[model samples]
Target: MDHVVVEPDSSSFSRVARALDDEASGEQWRAELATDLHAALELGVATVRGSLMGMATGGLDDGHEPLRQAVSASVESQVRMSGRGAGARIRARKITLRNFVNAPKRLNSRRGWRHPVHGDTETWVTQIGAPGWFDDPLRRLHARLHSAAARALDNRARRIARRG
Candidate 1:
């Protein structure tokens, strides 16, 4: 009778076990991943804010400088991550301009309105603003925001998976 024997590979098992058992390394890895995610969010928010600022300030009546500034200043973003999932929220923080909390909405939808000419009796003119000021930039940048987040996760995964 002939007999055959096989030996189990120990090196691979040991490496995997070491990696799993190193709690400090695991925690550090998690912290780095969170930092990377946060950095990505910051970058996305900055990009969106710049785009919003450009859109808010451009191609308007040029009469509502304060409104433009306020809208531009109101751009804000938040990132939330949990055991289940992660999310990013981009918005215009409520700004009270003329006691209007929805100033950004008003600016985005405002059409021509009757305005009295300065020092001119019985004379009035219509002032108009370019509509979709707020929504247009966000719509245009949606793809960019998604891609940025995906790239961040991909990069971190690649770095973690890199072998010596």
Candidate 2:
């Protein structure tokens, strides 16, 4: 797999971090970053799981269970680390892992729930409900995380381009 290296001098990191922080207050930013990181981590896990399922079903004929397992484990480990970030720290530690695991299931179950603003393409799942400090804050945080990650990745690409 090819990984993009971000130049230390690039403003993209700070820009993304600042944008995230500005979009939400300092406290909210932290929470959203954590939530987003958790979501990204789960996405990575789901990709691994999908790959494993594919291999099991003979969709991938190369017999890559070990590879898939390694990838999944790595993602899970990262998820655990990211879960310790700002927003996550605010929530109870014991439930963090459970929430991370359940996030995907919740998303999957809400496939039919259309987004009010964006129609069917943009949907949200509030499996844990929307009344608590943790719930809405985490949702917003996850959204910010997703945007920041994309920005970071784009910044990395731009850096690589400059180098090349």
Candidate 3:
């Protein structure tokens, strides 16, 4: 025969159980999470934009100033959530940087380009620029962005607890 048993203390358990059973509280939590997540995404976008601006100017030739200006002017972000509450997933709305950076000339700047020397002579001269201009910063900042989103959710949980 086994006699040992384990259970949550009644007061704490009932408080949590009641909160979970309340539909309004669930909705409130989801709304707050969405808000927090959006803020985090905006922060991430701004940070990446700043980095991209620096990379564009510092790595590219002065002739590419337009690219730097475009980055500063055009970088933007949006966040969207799908599914309900607990199952919900937040994602950045599709980025439109492609429209600005995917053009034939821009793509060469992004991926790095070599010039035809002396009117298509046998020599090739590569230009100086930050290759992987768009992806490198994002890839570098991926961990920081994830932590920011997680911190927002953690803050949301703390906020809900305080309200409860």
Candidate 4:
């Protein structure tokens, strides 16, 4: 496991910094600038990750069209916000929506780890994004989805046994 360090620059912190700058007051700005920026970046990345995960896996289990639509709507809204909030200038985009458009593409295409023996069996651990953005959330989502699938299968087997 490679330790992927997220080294953001002044450009990436500019927008959120400005926003927090205007809103933050006195000690909040003075004492915790670094901490505030870190928290904001974490939160911003979390939002982006959540949006991507929802879009990528929302329909997986039951192929729920409504859930997919909701996720689509959410991402579209984020894209729209990215367009309006700071256009391409949002500092958070570097860790958040920098490649927002490309994320779904990578999730579908490059992210699969196919079973060696069972070619059709694969997991969605996204081979996407820089260190902070895609891989971490993708791995977490894969684990969560795998766990959910196992639980569903277990319930199904129990039902079958009961029927038998």
lDDT leader:
1
Among all windows of 10 consecutive residues in model 3, the one with the lowest summed lDDT is 87-96
Candidate 2 lDDT trough over 10 residues, lowest sum: 87-96
lDDT score at residue 160, model 4, on the 0-100 scale: 38
Model 1: lDDT equals 0.61
lDDT of each: 0.61, 0.40, 0.55, 0.38
**lDDT per residue (tens digit) for residues 1-164 in model 4:** 67877766877567556554553544543334334333333434455446554543322343323332332333321211123452111122211122234333334344532222212335433333233334455455554444543454455445434433
Q: Model 4 misses residue 101 by how many Å?
A: 8.7
lDDT of 2: 0.40
TM-score of 4: 0.25
- Per residue, candidate 3 scores C-alpha lDDT tens digits across 65-116 of 3655554445444444454434223222232342333332343254555555
| Residue lDDT tens for model 2, 1-164 | 59986576557767765655554445654455556655544543454344433433212333433332332233341322234362222222222131243332222232322222323436653332112222333454566556656664455446445543
Model 4 regions more than 4 Å off:
1-103, 106-134
TM-score of each: 0.53, 0.24, 0.48, 0.25
Per-residue lDDT for 1-164 in model 1, tens only?
A: 59887755888666655654552267676676666666655654566456545652323353554666667778766555554546665667777764445666555666645556555658987645446655676677778767877787787656644431
Q: List candidate 1 stretches off by more than 4 Å.
A: 1-65, 83-85, 110-129, 162-164
Instruction: Give per-model CA RMSD.
Output: 8.0, 20.0, 7.2, 24.4
